[model samples]
Target: MLLSHDITILSPALALEDCEFPAIFNFGDSNSDTGGLAASLILPPPPYGETYFHMPAGRFSDGRLIIDFLAKSLGHPFLSAYLDSLGANFSHGANFATGSSTIRLPNRILPAPGGYSPFTLTIQYSQFLQLKNRSQLIRHRGGIFASLMPKEEYFSKALYTFDIGQNDLGEGFFDNQTLQEVNASVPDIMSKFSTNIKKIYDFGARSFWIHNTGPIGCLPYVLATYPSAQKDEVGCAKSYNEVAQHFNHKLRVAIVQLRKDLPLATFTYVDVYSVKYSLYKEPKRYGFELPLVACCGYGGKYNFNSSAECGGTVEVNGSQIFVGSCKRPSARVNWDGIHYTEAAAKFVFDKISTGAFSDPPFPLKQACHRNLD
Candidate 1:
């Protein structure tokens, strides 16, 4: 119930869980971003946070991102954005996610054709390193600042979650890179991702929950762009989804190797792509409608206009046009053509949290434990 600057703190979330994860340090893009992008650059306008926060809460969705739900489920308040200095409380942990983030830096750091962030995975890793060292320094001061910072022991006991790489594919696709060119970049992209994972593992992070990239081709933006491209039963671009599968395949392989290298770490590779794909494939079965359409967008067959995103004002010959949301967002899968709605996110979190889609077959509650086999 408490909406902090960078995150929404579940009012009764202070009673820590029996799972023993005192904090959660997340890294990734907008899927799990609390407010890192909003704090650094442009804030997501009204209706962005309407479903949950009822205001502009700095999230890209119409409500809670998966990270928000993950925090609440773990009996912790929402994570404060490491970039957000205003009214931030990092007692539990911090989020280093930003919209449009990629494992490799984009050719241009400028705002996307819409808006892309400058916080790449490397930059997020750098921020994480800074927080790990400086939080202790501030806590050593022993004041209100100390109260807001995470305890020294939380670093080793915290859950480390990642939900990036989607943007890496998006960036390549949008830049007019051929399908083969984007697919070819998977290995190097994953190498950097694995390198960052290893870097964090060296920093005493034991519990890692990494999400493979989702179906980028199913997104309305991509669908709109390649309208004539081949479509599956679900109407998603088959080739594009194949690229996502390629990315996930490389990512899983990297994770398996990482486990062999970092013996002490417990890495839970969550197959969120399948969960998300199923929703789009059978929207009605998942209590969703218009799986490919943007609930908050303007124009076209998918209710998405790339030039005019959700909750934005566009000019039409000197007159302003307010791009808004649909009345039934909870029933829609896509939020702003790029992100998932709160409802769809909840579905993803519910499925993945069960461990049914996870490697090592362990639920979120048992992510701290390593698999014997």
Candidate 2:
């Protein structure tokens, strides 16, 4: 309840503080997924966590994720996945994110470990709602695991973070929707996103740190998928990135509306697209190389092959081809075809945490205060 306005926080690429946020309740897709997908789905095999954990640590990157960096900055342990039961400690807060998640449930469903996760935003919220109530009971029950659960007050004081919606756009592409159709769907997608924010707001969330969708076209997957798609000056698909920009524009408008709707809450809409795009546009400026290619992918134009993903093996003429990481992951930007490398993730966190890319122009340390303009 009594949060000091102290502006002393640490960054992971710098771990990111004087503990600006007491706790962080994160929601979204793989961009911030700690381990929800791995717990319920296939575990990311070797080399996924080789750069940091030196083992399969349930992260998609070749090291830590942006969420991990954020936790380090706040001086709190990495948030345990709400779905992870093995050795999870949620005393600070919990992550409700998963890989291949969408704001709204997907229309197309494949049987048994489908293309996308069934743990949609709504489902994640339901899980959080359960935790919110159950933690109250657990704290009072006085069990041994009670210490691992979050305190009742942490819910109200924690930083609410979101880094989702990119997958929703990807789903549209997968469904064979035209670019215009995907562009038209942004409003409805954002509507669902806003509704979820309202639900979390009603549940006592006061400080929000939301990241806008990045340049979807910059990813090797998109580039490979739509070989005929238009390209930007930086060799990314221009139309796809435009759609992402459109989404970010609407997301900002939604934040403005949310600020008015929830008078007591502070909303920071972070512009992660610009920061991410810069990585591709100017990799050398940041000590990065091969910005457009995947560091842990197999052979292809972008070092990515969807059939033979990073850390995966495929048979070629009865011989197995092992997909591994590059020699120096720190020198690369993209991790897998779909995710950013830990180095890139760290670079992104350092820039965004400074509040240079946030709405209302407030740094992460000062994000709790409501912005008047």
Candidate 1 C-alpha lDDT tens digits along 127-191: 99999899899989887798888888898999999999998888888889998999999999988
- Alpha-carbon lDDT, every model: 0.88, 0.88
Q: Which stretches of candidate 1 lie over 4 Å from their true place?
A: 1-18, 112-115, 315-319
Give all candidate RMSDs, comma-separated: 7.7, 4.5
Candidate 2 per-residue C-alpha lDDT over 283-333 given as tens digits, one digit per residue, 9 for 90 to 100: 999999888888888877898888889988978789998999999999999
TM-scores of the models, in the order given = 0.93, 0.93
Query: Which parts of model 2 are misplaced by more than 4 Å?
Result: 1-20, 109-114
Steric overlap count per candidate: 2, 10
